[model samples]
Target: MAGGFTTMKTLLYRLFVLAILLSPVYTSDHSAMCAEAATPQTAAQKQKAAAQAKKKKEADKKRAQKKKEQVKKQKAQQKAAAEKQEARAKQQEKAAKAQAQKQAQKQEEEEELKQAWLRQQAELNSSTPKKEVVSLINIGAKFGYAGIMDKMTNNYANISRPNELDNDYAYHSLKGGPGAGLSLTYELQYGAFRFETGFDFTYLNSTSAYEFSLMRRLEQPYGGNYFYITDDLRETRNAGYVGLPIMFGAQFSRYYFMAGAKVGYGLFGNYKQRGRYDIVVKDDALRDPYGLGIHDVPTLAKDQRKLSLQQPSVSLCAEVGIDLDEWLQAQPDKKNKKRTKPGERLPFGREHLHYKLGIFAEYGILNTNKPTGALPLSFNADDPYPQQTNSMLSIADTRVNNLFVGVKFAIQFEIPGKVARPIPAPASAAEISVFDKESMTSLTTAIVQVKNTGNNRTIMKPKTLSKGVIRQRAAVGEYVAMAKAKNYYPESVAFTVDSPGIVVPVKIYMQRRPVFQVKVTDKETGAALAAQVQITKRNDKETAYSMQTDSVNGLSEVMLQDSLQYALHIEQIGYEAVDTLISDIGDKMHISLTPIKKGEIFVMKNLFFATNKTRILSSSEEALEALFGYLERNPEIRIKIMGHTDNVGKDEANQRLSEGRANAVREDLIKRGIDETRIEAEGYGETLPVDTNDTEEGRQNNRRVEIEIL
Candidate 1:
């Protein structure tokens, strides 16, 4: 940027210097032309006219500036294009690389699995398989929450006998977190069975703190002195292990007998600092160690080395589960060869099997140096003696034992369809058509004639997308109600009976409706109206109603059967009638009908008023005859009466006239027994006009009163 700015400045200075040097030439030319003009030569004066010359100079400067701007814009566009192209190329390269890597990894795994399957198949084909007719796959979760894995160690804390640390040892259980596992299996000849394998891992980090009575050390010393732990030493089992267990089983019908072993080599097992040391030296009747020497003498203290609680280890287990259902399925009779087709696959019908729950038990063989517990339970508080705070119990030298007990739940399923195949797809449309004996080539249909009777315009039109693409184009579900009466469908040839002979004919529907559905309204007032809407059809007597416009939507659609001279009428509560035919649809058919003034106001056709008077005259009885007819035709013709008077007399008279006229109309309507429940009357006296009141003709036109459909 700095370099560019410097270059620009240098160029500007050069241009300025050149312009200054050329100043004399222009001045000299101007002086010569002026002097020649003063000599009265009309040719010279015309050659350099002041206004023309000035305009030409300004135009030249403007042209130069515009040219510079164009060059700059072109360079900018080129730079942007280059950047965009580079970015696209890089993105494409990255995507290709990632796709290639993914494909390669998938292929590698597939190849490996393929090879393994081949090996299994070869072995199976070479020998008779050991058969076990059973079914069940049960999983279990074992939590090491109550027990610390055991380890056999030569540490001081592990003393077999309380006072015989040098002679023997004992082991204490380690405590930890929770763990779980999963299993898989299959059915065999005998009963229910499982080939289960799963993983479980946990961590146990415990804190130990203690306070003990200070005691004198070195008996008979010259000066009596009390001894205390200078620092805290802790024993924390923050170790963890992942277990892999695989078990096999056999089911004696309702009796499930299972035995499988799981071997898990210790992933990692170790101890951390946080526990104080515990010694029996002071408590022992003999204050000193026994004659036999032991590296760690018993002394209840908080200072000691954290025992190396870590060890590479291995363990094994066996478990069993059962299902209580004793139901046995009956065998199928052999098929008669004469009644069967050759090369037909065996039926091997689906198994409708049921299952029940049962109990389970397991046992394990402990290994490694730590004092591990065979069972997940503890005698009390998990420590046999949790009150013995951070003190290392003299348990390392003890003998360990195996465990076996407990019960759990189980379920079974007889898988359907070989090990894999699922339901196949149904026959194709063409095949179904053939079976039905219907024509493969069906008819086309349009929906231009089917108009939405919904009131809301926004809800009427299909929503188009941001880029103008219809993301969710309007569509009718295939479950359209089919009946014989008023068959307005199959507008275009796209929809037709695919089958004509068998059962009900199958019809093919189009993705998009072919008819141009229109919502008509008055362009001047944004109002809707009723018209003699026509939707020509090939079958004219199909009972199809020409006027589908309801109170909600002033619209009707058709397939555009013949000429598109569809009549349109703009009918609103106050506007006069407008009748026209739409022939030109420049764009997607959004036809707006501009209503020419048919009447000054919209008075209810069924409503009436006094003849030329504001009184509620009784003779105006039948003005609403047609209105009643309309109500009979449309049960929901809600209406209101609006009265207007021309500018005359005083403001109060005009107002009274307007109000009286409206009331008179209402009264006559009520007299005809039109429901007063559906009407309200309002008067606007001389406030609006049909034309300008500046002339006598315009005033006369405005002086008249009019009725309005509110």
Candidate 2:
């Protein structure tokens, strides 16, 4: 940018210098031309000059008239061309609209036919019964091998035993045991997926043999050192548990797969030990310094006792199986005379049975670790008392987890839950037609609601008319038919069907409803803000009609009543809410909301208190909840409640009443779990008046309670 500026400045300087140099020449040339024109003329020259001027005036007038005529002719041609173009555009637009209407009519007819067919199929399904049997309750039995996984570890060590180190050992091996359970599973199904969960009396048992030895140090005479070992020659742990399994699986044809977890409680446990060991003593000055001390002469020292196991053990199991009942059900049984078909339930006192055989595997994911109350032994034959040499020890540990992998066989009884049979109907058909009165055309895609008014029951759900007609079996009755569609007013027609063989035509027309839209903006800044809008029918107060608007654009498409008037209510926090009446739907409406500023008070238009009391009315619940939600959203903001009354009562009574009302609002908010420090309450009675107290409207305005943002 600097270089460009410098270059531009240099060019401007050169141009200035050039203009200065050419100034003298320009002035000298101008003066010479003036001197030549100032020279005097004779009488003959003057006469020639006057004649030339007369010719020039006539030429100038002719040229001006010619230019004006040319401009008028060009404008006339341009206007004619513009008119032609506009006519062509109007013709094209009319053709396009006609084509679009034709296509829409065709699509509507096709949709009407599809909807009619679907309605007929639904009615038929509802009237018919199933031919096959579905299982409602199931009872089964399952048995599998339970493998005890002994993941031995010393996560906890004994601080009392100085010679024993807990973590210096490892788990060698584990073994599997027999397991069985009685299952009573109730099946919950979702299409092809099935979930099974129930109580089971499961007996889970396993045995584990592992090696985890502890270290011990022994002191000899004459400042000597020695070592002792509490070697586990052969140790066995057995445990039993009762478990509950909740499994989910999917079945495809005859094959299935399942995966889930099982929770169990420990029933019993047994711990057994059989081992022998010797100690190695080291001394430098004595005879036979590398002495091999004999501990109990390597005899069999058997210790068998009951072990305590942790409760509520959890494991995950998976299964894959096939239904054995499918093959059995496929076979023919000549003994049963009421059998209808293959895979069908037989009549009379007969029940269907299903059998399943599957392989399963379960692995315990939690650690069941506890201490074994055994001690490391030290032998000293040189001591006077040989029997008192060994003492009870601490600091040893063990862990036992479980894993089961085997096969399970189950037999389940299925009870049928559905009835399926066909019903007879009339062969002939009757027809109904729908129409549009505004366009004088057959209306398609308009749904028809059929009600048997004579019987006071709905004969059929709303079915769309196909090709502007509905064909169905007719009964000898009077029926009310209603036609409805989006953006169209609903119309109903009553007709009678005398017989079943003939086509009964009933036509109904629908009127089009106009679309309405509204755009909301801020009154002061003309900026858009999200506003809550509601439209309620004047006579029917039970149902509210409303639509959500975009927060950024503050625009919404609202639904309006057909002929009835409605109240449109729109509100935004920190602004005054507005209410207006809408007689009919029209173009987009532009509405502006007045924003409330800090320290500016606004009356709560909908909030009402009892007569001369502070208790709020039930109709004010929605307003209070909205206020609470606003406070929750704006945590840092604070507000003050100010109450006032009209000047009709005693001054002291009025002041006390106003104060009570203001304080009541504050107390209610505090009870709703809002912090008391963020709110303040005050009352001015009739002191700070908003309007004159002479008129009723002014008094009503003065009796309002207001809130000001602080």
Every candidate's lDDT: 0.42, 0.65
Q: Of the candidates shown, which would achieve the greatest TM-score relative to the real structure?
A: 2
In candidate 1, stretches whose alpha carbon ends up further than 4 angstroms from where it belongs are: 1-146, 149-175, 180-192, 196-217, 220-235, 238-246, 250-259, 273-363, 370-396, 399-645, 649-710
> Over the stretch 121-191, how does candidate 1's per-residue lDDT look in tens digits?
45445565334233334333332322343333454321222212221222233433333233333433331
- Taking all chains together, the TM-score of candidate 1 against the true structure is 0.29
Top candidate when judged by lDDT against the true structure: 2
How far out, in Å, is residue 301 in model 2? Answer: 13
Summing lDDT over every window of 10 consecutive residues in candidate 2, give the lowest-scoring window.
384-393
| Off by more than 4 A, model 2 | 1-145, 154-162, 166-171, 175-178, 201-213, 217-232, 283-304, 329-351, 372-398, 419-710
